[model samples]
Target: MAATGGSGRSTVADLLAAGMAADGASAVVLDTAPRLTSPWPSWTVGQEAEGLAALPPDRPLTRSHVRHAAALRPGADRPDWHVLTDGRDWHSPPLTLPQAPAAWLQLAAIGGWQCVVADTPHPVTHDLLQSRCAGHIGLTRSWCELPYAVPVLCASATAGGVQALQQAVMALHAEGMPLQRTVAVLVAQTDGRLPAVARAGATMLSARIAAVVHIPHDPHIRAHGLRTVTRLRSRTRHAAGLLFHEVLAAAGASWGTPLPDAPRPAPLAVVSHS
Candidate 1:
């Protein structure tokens, strides 16, 4: 979850999912943003594919539905990560997006993918302020509480962003969220020196979380959207790699010893082969 808008939430999500897939981990990205604004589920299996709206939670989720709703086109070589998001066009009137609980219900049906990288809406801290406490914990809480979930909290490496993140961390701690297993990321806006607030924020917040990672500014990402993983600079990639390692370590801490891979039925090839 992110504390503010433009906090590199999607950038982190893409990096984690793509990195996992490149390492042969079964991973998928769930984009919890609207089609008009989201950068995921760029395309689907067919022109008529309706993304998550087509894969309703009323029926059990299957590997076929998972792939069909994903961004992949038919017969395309499976890329490192697959995206699931609202695929509807701009002309269409907006439909009510699924809440985190409903999205989690749909997630429970899928059998294969080992990791789900969720790129959620912005200003989660703001939302909590307006929402009911107990009922609104939603995916932010559900996914974190999982046996092997690794929560990565994001905020822009700015003074306001740091303050927002601190508020969120304190609120989550109050709500019994797993701060120990959480990884905090500060997305830097420039290659120049980080603000005193950013540095001090990291120092102040270090004791409350697993570890903090800072992503250096990448000109490529600023010019173009986060599409090609190779475009990331060496330093940026290094940060991503470190972030991935922290995520793995945190997830490992959740389950202690690694769990054996669950057996799969023949029909579901690698959790619905692309």
Candidate 2:
């Protein structure tokens, strides 16, 4: 989640989901932003395909239904990491799509996505407030409460951006959100230049969040807008790896009850060195 755009929100979402898929997990990136502006279909084959909006939110969505609706990754099979977003054009008729967090959870549950990375829309602080008041559970809160969900907060690497990000983080903390498991990513829009305020902000934020990682601006991503992640600079990939590791460390715990027994060392050989 991010306070605003240009925060690398979509980039972060794509990286996490794609990385998980490459690691053999069933991952899906859910686009919650407006259809017209969403980047999910930017370079994939989903530009003109039926997407999340086409699925019948009122009825159960099967794997086949989801696969048919999604925009598959490049060189990926049906079951590989897919992106679910809008497929409408300017002339297309209006469509009804689910926006509530619960609705998305249901979709993910039915689709059986082992990992869901959502690229949310603007004004996340407002969303956090809306979901907390008057007995409402907004998308932000619901996703935060997902079992073992590690939230990745993004902000541009700038003074103004970091200040705004700090405010958003404060709001989330006031809402009792999990800062311990959350990771903050400072996305450098310019290469080899990070503002002093952003650096200081990261230092302060490090005390409150799980980890703070910096993503160097990749000229390729800037030019292509996540058209393909394979061409990312090695440094960018390394930073993404750090973000992934921090999230995994935060999730290091049993899934639930009936937990499998912890591995015990085999009894030492009883031959007594015989």
Provide TM-scores for the models: 0.81, 0.84
lDDT string for model 1 (66-171, tens) is 7777663221122455677777766777657766644543463463577777777856566555454556555566666554667788989998889988999987
Across residues 1-274, which tens digit of lDDT does each residue of candidate 2 receive?
Answer: 9987778888887777756765667778888766667777565643555886679665545667877787866523213577888766645665666666666666666676666777777567878777677577777787787656778899999887898789889988999988888888899989886888888999999999888888888999999888776677878766755776667766663243333333222322334343
What are the RMSDs of all candidates, in order? 5.6, 11.0
**Clash counts for all predictions:** 0, 1
Top-lDDT candidate index: 2
